[model samples]
Target: MEPAQLTAAVVSIVNTLRIILEYMQNRPKRRQHEDDFDEDVDTDVPESTGCGNWEIVVAVGLVDTVERQFWARQTSTDWWDRIVLQVWDDAQWLQNFRMLRPLSWNTVSYFPLPKMRADLTVEKRVAIALWKLATPDCYRSVRNQFGVGKSTVGAAVIQVASAIIGVLLLRVVTLGNVQVIVDGFAAMGFLNCGGVIDGTHIPILAPDHLPNQYVNHKGYFSMVLQALVDHKGRFTNINVGWLGKVHDTCIFRNSGPFEQLQEGTYFPDQKITIVDVDMPIVILGDPAYPWLLWLMKPYTGSLDSSKEQFNYRLSKCRMVVECAFGCLKAHWRCLLTRSDLSTTNIPIVISACCVLRNICESKGKMFMAGWEVEANRWHLILSTQTPG
Candidate 1:
């Protein structure tokens, strides 16, 4: 073969191969995932690197301005409406519930990515956490609605819930200053009643790690939220870490109130004298709880006229706790829906809801409609006067 013919054939083969490679590289790929666009790019930005082109500089600047505008448009009213927090613009409820009494959005605004539209403030993140509890929207919905990542939505909920559980749980659900609850129960016609206990189920998805642990006798995945509510629908005590399969009796037995009652330290020296009997102060419970001196349960099976009347009165008062649970579930509709949180985090979420619910109860629901601007300086009411 001649030298010219050999060179031409080699050149033709190389050109054909290059064309096929280019076509393969440019072909459209199947959309496999929700966040495929977020594929990890080699965005290893050089520390001292500047924009190599004027177009890149203008694009980055334009994106940054748009992001700032979107974030600036975050309204507290949107939070209230979405979270069902029943608050208004700069409402006291938002301040009290999120535990950001003094911190405003200016103090908590996060510097967002260049092209990302909106970023959440600290207060908004807490509000989003509460909104996740109040609405049935999933993480994807939150991501789309807030212009954040799905993982960011989950992280926000967890972070805010942790804060609430740390700062507000002990303050609201405590034995130290619950004399108000005891007095309220006395007025409700239940003698010597300090609190009313009840159990509710929060629906959740069957856990992937241990599916059997989440299945209840009702044949669904859930967890128990055993709470002791006051006459005004405030949660004075709560225990919510147990699995759905666990019975109410088992949960009550392991609760802090039950442990206190067993040690005879719950409201010691506060016995009520009736019929020449020195009956210890007691918290009302349904038949699900074991009858004890400090824990009164309605009589099971049969009852005389006097016993029936007593049971009726106790049940009527105990319904206060049920109403409290109803109110909590009604406001936080997420509790009614199947939760996306893991089994370990489910308790944390419920605890956060309880804290928020107590905050609302403290600021009476009657004040929801006529939110007075001056009322924004609301403080926790503490009292030392015990029931005589």
Candidate 2:
């Protein structure tokens, strides 16, 4: 057969490149004014054009248009539908979005009309903040993804998170829900358990003002997210913003929850009799917490027959806090690493994580992944507890 006749059998790299060049030359250059989104998309073809020159220009234009459309869609007023729906599954996103409208107002509620910008919708603002908490990406990355300014992203994060914490704290963590919490522990065979308290260190970048103060005994810069998790992997009370250098017990002692317990305001006037001794409901804590009438801590090092049994039961119930931390951190992987947020704003971010965690739980969001890995940060108390 003639070479030209047999040419249908194959095409070499040079031929393919030639064909691509021919295709680009014929393929109409995307009209610069094809759409309103492409008003100023100037694709500069660098000097020294090769056979692939037109292809690069067309490819650049294509990327530019697609990216503009993507950012437009993401930054649209209907961000709940475009961005939030895409990030969180439809079921979970809609389930927890009831408060988005109400809480979103907090962002601009305090500002005067002159200061408020209508270009960014409340839904978009909240979505940006939620994205910051729900992923490990930096806020600047999130800003670029959504076509919003980085500073706007940071401000929206704190405002939206603070609003969420204020709105959800009472609804999710109040003592009014103590009975349900008690029932949760009872089912686990920990009698009269009120709450599970544990403190997890939230790693952070060194602070500008006081880097030394933020460094913990283990020699890492961090803040502590001291939580009072109830049974069923929910945080009932959270005391965040404490420096990692401080001990968990000391942080607990200064918390509002502890003040309530100490002042006899933690629980209503009621008593549950255990072992013939009438006592108010109490939290189940690890050794890092002081053992008090309102708290139960596991026995240290040596354990006798019954004391060993008591410690075992306590460990099982107290494990809920660890599980709770696992679930919380797993849902929001941002907490697993050192965040770029400044020391003053880190607590707001942590509080926001807790708030969203409860919202997911409150709306029956699924957590099939279940618990996160155990970090094994325990301050085991060496002092023995005398039997009641």
Pairs of residues at least 3 apart in sequence or in different chains that clash in candidate 2: none
Residues 1-388, candidate 2, lDDT per residue (tens digit)? 7897567545554566565667667766554443544321323443333445545545444444333222222343344556554665544543333234334344324422223367666666776776677666786578667776666777778877777666666776554477888888888877777888888877777777767888776667788998887787777788999987899989988988888889878766567887899888788888877879879999888779989988888899988888788777766666766778888888888887887777667666344332243222211110121111
Q: In candidate 1, what residue range of length 10 has the lowest lDDT sum?
A: 379-388
Best by lDDT: 2
Clash number by candidate, in order: 0, 0
Residue-wise C-alpha lDDT for candidate 1, range 5-115, written one tens digit per residue = 999999987876665555445545523443443421212322212323332433334334232111122223354446433534445544333323333232222323122
Quality of model 1 by C-alpha lDDT? 0.65
Query: Which stretches in model 1 have alpha-carbon errors above 4 Å?
Result: 1-119, 176-178, 366-388
Model 2: lDDT to the true structure:
0.68
lDDT of 2 at 78: 45
